[model samples]
Target: MEKREWKVCVTGGGSFIGSYLVNKLLQKGYIVHATLRSLKDAKTGILRGFPEAKEKLVLFEADLYSPHQFEAAIQGCDFVFHVATPLNHEPGSSQYKNTVEAALAGSKTIFMSCLRSGTVKRLIYTASVLSSSPLKEDGTAFKDFVDETCWTPLNDSLSYVYHDDHHKDYTYSKTLTEKEMLSYNNNENGCGGLEVVTIPCGLIGGDTIQSFASGSIAVCLSLITGNSETYKSLKFLESLLGKVPLVHIDDVCEAHIFCMENSSMKGRFLCASSYVSIAEIAGYYIQHYPEFNVKQEYVEGKKVDVKWGSTKLCEKGFVYKYDTKKILDDTIECARRIGYL
Candidate 1:
């Protein structure tokens, strides 16, 4: 059968990354089965505007709270992109337990659904680099650089500790979810093993299809908007990796497609286009749009340098197209179009 005739399911199809992935798959002529947590969002209607979407695309409502909810969407699909995550609640909130449970249960449910389908050859998960720590096991010092080989050390404060311990709750949740995603390899469910691949991406920037700007895009825009609270994202990322690691949402979506096409690839692939200082990012923002009066204080030396490398993805012949400037450009343009600016 031709590539265009294959069926692929993308969960969280209305999200920042999922929306782009769904559109790209459609553009490449594949029949896309996309899932959103709810069908009531008026914004998701734009998905149907894509080329040939009326005939080639289908949308389903699936949420992690309900196990087996994704069965209808995953049935007979050749590939599945598990892009939805259950971190919508604040880490310390009362719903935190439900958040964690949903992640584990939802991930297990997706894996089983794919195995039972008997048609899915690959499952690509949307992962985050925040789950990885660049430090040594003892947390005494930084490693040479973070790569696909790096794992968040066991019982590390940021890795496992939660519930009023620290503000790394979201990071910890993602760490657990990613590990659960990889644990399904060679699972003992009788069916042939399902091939799983994950892309642990950096702070994702660039355009989005949603009616509103995504959290990541909003944080980047904070540099000029004077929203100091949003700096927590940078501080958290920098403290963990020793630098700000960034990648365009477009590049991230492309890497997912790259992994799906290269069936032999396995394990986690670290996806980052630039590893730089917050000061550097501030300078670039000022250079491109000085009228915003980018704060110079953010450029002061705030941390040391520890590289987050994408050598694995690059070695797999995946090339990154957007740099820091292009990411900001696309993000700003989209934000303005959506009235977030």
Candidate 2:
């Protein structure tokens, strides 16, 4: 069979990364089965707008809360990409507990469905960097660079201790879900004889193929689109002093494809390109787009020193296509086209 005829399923196809993944898959000539939380959502329009979507794309409605809904979606898929995870960043939101619960339950549902499908050869899971490393509380550098072996020191006790902090809650949930997934992968009886690979990514940023901004792009839009309150609150001067691991969205999608096609690739792959500060990003925008009234404030806070390395991925012979400058330019251009500017 030709490459275009291969079958694959992408859970959460409506997501920022998932949507882009779907587009790339279609371009490669694969018959894509994309899942959405609701067919009426705007993402349906975005997915339908892709070239040849009518011929190559099939849509399925699935929810994390309901695993049974995914059975039909993955029935005959050669590969499965589990890219759906609930994120609630708002502090003091009532949905915080529900978000954590749904994430854990949803992962369980999908993993079991993949095993039961009996057709899935490889399952690529999209995990976050928070699962492996914790942000520095004091804003100091990590004693050493973080690699796949470094697991965040989060547990039941820490969860309770940091209960008041929503960010920590998010971190703890991701850490827990990743641990469970790994444990399931190692289980001789639980995997149902399938291969699993996890990609733990950092802050993902780039020009999205979709019409609207999502994920980290949305945050960047707020910074550049006259959101002075967001700019003032970010404390870019102090926070930018610390190293932040970032990966382009396209790089992230390529990482997923690389893992899916390479049978030997397994375990956790850190998908970050470089560490940069907020000030550098701001400077790029100001220098390139002088017409926009960008905020230039420098507030010195505790210096943060955190580093996440992707040496393992590099050794696997996967090269990143976008650097910091390219990422900024592409992201800004996309934002402007989408009218976020």
**Among all candidates shown, the one with the greatest lDDT:** 1
The most accurate candidate by TM-score is 1
How many angstroms is residue 245 displaced in model 1 relative to the true structure, after the best TM-score fit?
1.3
lDDT of 2 by residue, 149-186 (tens): 76766544432221244455566677778777777767
Which residue pairs come into collision in candidate 2? Answer: 4-29, 139-303, 139-304, 140-305, 141-305
Q: Which tens-of-lDDT digit does each residue in 1-341 have in candidate 1?
A: 67778899999888888888999999898999999888887646878888879999998988777758999999989999999987565345442365666677788889889988999988898888877777777767778788877776646443422123334556666778888887676467644757888888888888887888888888778887777556766666676777877899989989999998884766888888988887888888888888889888888856675766659888889999999888888888888899988
| Reference-based TM-score of each model | 0.91, 0.85
Task: After superposing candidate 1 on the true structure, give the runs of residues whose Cα lies further than 4 Å from its correct spot.
Answer: 90-96, 154-167, 186-191
On a 0 to 100 scale, what is the lDDT of residue 161 in model 2?
A: 22
lDDT of 2 at 206: 85
